[model samples]
Target: MPPADGPSAPPGGDEVDRIVAAWRRVAPDLDVEPLEVLSRVARLAHHLDRLRRGAFAAHELETWEFDVLAALRRAGGTHELSPGQLVVQTLVTSGTMTNRVDRLERRGLVQRRPAPDDGRSVLVRLTPAGATVVDAALADLVRAEHRMLAVLPAGERRALAALLRRVTAPFETTARG
Candidate 1:
């Protein structure tokens, strides 16, 4: 649950009264019902941001670091992936991905190697240390997500995920197309 003063709730009776008055006079014909759902999305995103910060902080990892590490982790054992592949999976600019890889390499988390099939390209693989860090961080992250989901009943959580997938399906299909 969010704090009482969190944006998920209306500001106050007075503020709501003023908004109702303004809407009644200024846009009487416009349906404001969508605002309720959109506002909750905005508020929930804000809350989730805080949760993510705290969760990542526990493993001494920033959100961006986790983004990269998690991508490699998902690639399977040895956590090997090309820089280009990481950029695609991470949805980051090539330069940004290069910088991230450099930082991770410097921290002894990952290494770059000549690509087996391509002389002009390199593959980034997680070192043993990197694998350990990613494993620990992933465990912590899963625990945090589990805690968050605990607020909802199991059935409701599944329903919410299904609904969100339905909402997002068109965008995913368009992007793929």
Candidate 2:
């Protein structure tokens, strides 16, 4: 049921709408238009992170752990990649990647072995346990995501995804530290 407040916002308006409304009332000249889109994106990202945390935790994994595992799982049949490669795919510093790998190693979710071509470098391989956990977590994540987007039709979801990709393309292409 909707809130029985003093005055209801127009159809489909939400909390962000209320905020924008207030900002509009306060600063009639300033261009707060961007907030209408970016603010909701920020709020949605928060919800997504929370949902992912719950989904991954149920599979005994952390968000970072799932990221590494998912990277490996997408690395074709071998399901392995060099630490440098993992760093690139995960957008983490090499040092951070090493620490992440160390923690994951302790949890028995990944294993390190000498690279076939490079004697000095080692490749990180996802253990069977890792694959199972990541796969299950992914399934759970997808189901939650599906429910979240259920309000939108299938075509809208695809279009939204494409639009999001366009919005994210610049960030994805930019160098990260």
Candidate 3:
């Protein structure tokens, strides 16, 4: 079977031509739209993955490492959080979180410490070295993101973000619940 979202041939020319013809017949007053904007967004995200891989590679960090490290960095001063907390922030399974923490600890980037009030639990705290790497990586990542957003004016970028948030808000709430 053809993919559900794949373009159908136009009736007289190709899929879209057919779609327009049918629309014209069924609803003469309605507009038949171009799919360019949404299509481009999807295509651009694919290309952006390549650019991101290069950016992460330059820092000698894997994408997974950046995900985990950035979550810790965003946890405010001292950059300490429990493995369970990291799992929530990063949206990874508990086993994956444990593995990431283990690898980072081995590299001396973070360490596991007893939770202050919970004897059976441990917190993952960024080491001085981890903090140094995260800070540098974040600076570089910001520059990369800025480069990607340069095509849009500041106001346009803000508007786009607002629109995207509106589109995604329902899904976000559903996921959280």
Candidate 4:
């Protein structure tokens, strides 16, 4: 098939295009329009995950390590957050976060200290080394993503981001736990 988007679609078509074409042939009654957009998003997500892994690995960091370190780095000012806050931001259970913090602490990437104002509460702080690694990983991740999005003009990228936000907002609001 020539694909749905006419001249704008890639001349040779992609895997999603082929899948849509095959599905159409078997079930012509169904509307496969959604696949053209969502399937591409799914594939892009897979590729992005790989890029993230590579970027983190280059910094000698694991994905979860990056997540926690990045969260702490983003905490500004003191570069620290209570363990509970870290759990929420990293979206992990307290036990998992505790183990991660322990591992990271052993590597000198983070430290736990009593909250200054609330001695009973403990806070996880990203060490300078952790900040450096997370920052480098973030830069690499952004550069890779920019390369992938280079095919689109700025305006189109903005428009696509807006469209994706609309698609994602509901799920984010509901599925965030």
Question: Could you say which candidate leads in lDDT?
Answer: 2
TM for every model, in the order presented, reads 0.82, 0.91, 0.77, 0.87
Task: Please say which candidate is ahead in TM-score: 1 or 2.
Answer: 2
Q: By summed lDDT, which 10 consecutive residues of candidate 1 come out lowest?
A: 1-10
lDDT of 2 by residue, 29-116 (tens): 9989899899999999999999999999999888999999999999978899999899999889999999999999999999999998
Q: Which stretches of candidate 2 lie over 4 Å from their true place?
A: 1-8
Best by TM-score: 2
Q: What is the C-alpha lDDT profile of model 4 across 38-136, one tens digit per residue?
A: 999999999988988998899998999999999999899989999898888878899999999999999999999998899898999999888888999
Q: Rank the candidates by lDDT, best first.
A: 2, 4, 1, 3
Candidates 2 and 3, the one with greater TM-score: 2
- For each candidate, how many residue pairs have backbone atoms clashing (under 3 Å)? 0, 0, 7, 0
The local lDDT score (0 to 100) that residue 54 gets in candidate 1 is 80
lDDT of 1 at 104: 92
How far residue 123's Cα lies from its native spot in candidate 3, in Å, is 0.3
- By TM-score, is 1 or 4 better? 4
Residue 39, candidate 2: Cα error in Å is 0.5
Worst 10 residues of 3 by lDDT: 1-10
Clash-forming residue pairs, model 3: 8-15, 9-14, 9-15, 10-14, 10-15, 10-18, 11-18
Which residue pairs clash in candidate 2?
Answer: none
Task: State the TM-score for model 4.
Answer: 0.87
- Give the Cα lDDT of each candidate: 0.80, 0.91, 0.80, 0.89
